[model samples]
Target: MGKRYTVPARQGLAVRLKKGEQVRVINTHGTQVVDSWAFNAADPTEFMSMEHMRQGINGIIPKPGDGLMTNKRRPILTFLEDTSPGIHDTIIAACDIWRYRNLGVEGYHDSCTDNLRMALVAIGFPVAEVPSPFNLFMNIPVRPDHSIGWEPTVSKPGDSVTFRAEMDLVYAVSACPQDIVPINGAGLAPVDAHLEVLAEA
Candidate 1:
């Protein structure tokens, strides 16, 4: 049986996955964003590089069967299944202190970068080398004019995306806490999400 756990609002988690094992992230109430990052278990320095992965795939958004690559351009994980419409974003950086401050809000608001750093440490990764995350269930649409659209989530409750670890890996996730925008459901308050480590079928 696979191990399942819930990540509360504005919180984070660190988990390990062996090669061939699959991990699924579920939007419990359709009101949360899961920011996920991965590292090579043998050498943390060679982590997933969104830039290389995207360029290798020749697309900004990855689809099922796409193999995500590392800075060294090696495949690390594969998108095995996506129950949602695959409307995720790789262009946007995870939220941080400087961003909130620029929005005229100050004083240490909760952020994805902070959550990722905290979560990754549990798996022995240094905070300084944290990479930009792969956002799941985030609806960032491109208009005909090439401008971005901030549409609310189109994923229904229980929607999920599962990934197969191409190598032994350490992964971290943060339930995004951006209440100022309607990105996370209503965005007024964050909610919990489900993370599961499923055995090979």
Candidate 2:
């Protein structure tokens, strides 16, 4: 048995992942992106790290079955499955001061942090307390020479991924607003994400 919930873009949604329940995120529309972050229910600040996540998962880039590890080396969530063949921009990171300056944009008028802040406010969390997030369905590939290139989205319409919470956890997600790069192609688009809680196995 599973409980299903749907979250639309620019909206905030919260769900408690009881130990052992599996959660799946479905990209209902193709090319839509989602950035996510997780915390221990007991202590929200102990967040997940992309570096640690990659290392803990054996230096492998996250994919289906990859586990996202917390700063304390605890398993926060496990990537149980993914339907999208590939996602976009993992290592390129969210937009910020450096990005805006480098892109020759006026300044950081809009960014992933801004979107995350909005989502937190909607969910009743103080905007200042929002944690760093995991970029789901984002692909940044490293070239053979060790350089990285922001690539186009590997996900197509209707792609999805499934994860299992290793502990009681709280998570936040946002459809990225990074139109300054190839990740979003030319503009920001809405992504539809659906969550389902699986019955105890």
Candidate 3:
């Protein structure tokens, strides 16, 4: 049982997840990228880890219903178990100076960090403590030869995943501003996400 809400891009929202309450994020449209992260409501410093999540998922690449677990082996959230395949990026990281130069784009004008900073401010968190995030719906696959390339998204419209917070938690999300690949319509389209808070079972 979750309460549903929608969030539009370039804007932000905040929700508090009581312990044992399951929450789901829905990608209403396909190919739209989202950058997400979670923090412990009690300690803020206790955050989700991309490395830990990858290791826990066994580097096999994740699909819907997969658990996004913490380093301590606590279940932070679970994929919503979509009937349609849910695609997520495993290799692409949040944008920074190196990426800006690699993309051959002008100076770093827009970025994920900027979006994240804004989100934190909106939620009344310390701006300086914002951490690295998890990229959802953006595909970055490693080749057998040990190279990496951006790949097509595995999710489509209306696909979603539920995350049951092990404790009271706060999350910050940004529909990505990736203009370097087809994952987000070659950086042309925007993403829409819907969140729902469910009653504890």
Candidate 4:
């Protein structure tokens, strides 16, 4: 049987999967965003690279069957299905303390970078190995003027996206805690998310 985990709002979790294992991420309450990062289990230095994915997939927004590449240009994960509106964005970097400071926020705030680092570190990754994440369920759309704009997620309860592991990997996910931004359900609150792994038949 596959394992299941619940990532609390503003927290993070780590999942290790063998090659060919499938993972499904569910937005339990709809409108919550999950920032996720993937790493090659054999070599942590060679992690997921958004630049490579952009170049390889060559799409403003990735589609089903698009392979998410690593820093070494190897396919790490293949997007299998999306039950939502299929509007997740891959262009933005995960949130961090510096970003909060830039926005005039005073103290330490929950950010994806911190969350991913904490989660991965607990799973044995070094503190210096943080990488950019693939923002799942995030709604950033390119405008007609060629600029991007943020919008609330359209994912409803039970909406989900599943991915097939192309290679053995350790994945990290953070339920974003940007309570001051509209990205988290109209800036109201972050909600819990569900994750589960499935073995290949």
The TM-score, computed over Cα atoms with residue i paired to residue i, of candidate 3 is: 0.81
Global lDDT of model 4: 0.86
CA lDDT, every model vs. true structure: 0.85, 0.67, 0.67, 0.86
lDDT per residue (tens digit) for residues 95-164 in model 1: 9998789877868898999888888876676656767788888888888999997667888899999999
Q: Give the distance in Å from residue 144's predicted Cα in candidate 1 to where it truly belongs.
A: 2.5
Model 2 local distance difference test score: 0.67
Per-model clash counts, in order, read 0, 9, 13, 0
Looking at model 4, residue 89 earns an lDDT score of 74
Off by over 4 Å in 1: none
Candidate 2 is scored at a TM of 0.80
| Residue-wise C-alpha lDDT for candidate 4, range 1-201, written one tens digit per residue | 387789999999988889999998999999899998889888889888888989998875677899999989989999999999887878889999998898899988888888888898888875466677789999988889988877789889989988988989998899998777688778569888989889874
- Candidate 3 lDDT over residue span 1-201, tens digit each: 455776675344456678877777777776666777777777776777667778887864566667776656665765555534655664556765567678798775466677777766776774456555667666777779989777657777876766667778877677766666666765566666777778876
Off by over 4 Å in 3: 1-4, 10-13, 63-66, 71-73, 127-130
Candidate 1: C-alpha RMSD to true structure equals: 1.4
Most accurate candidate by lDDT: 4
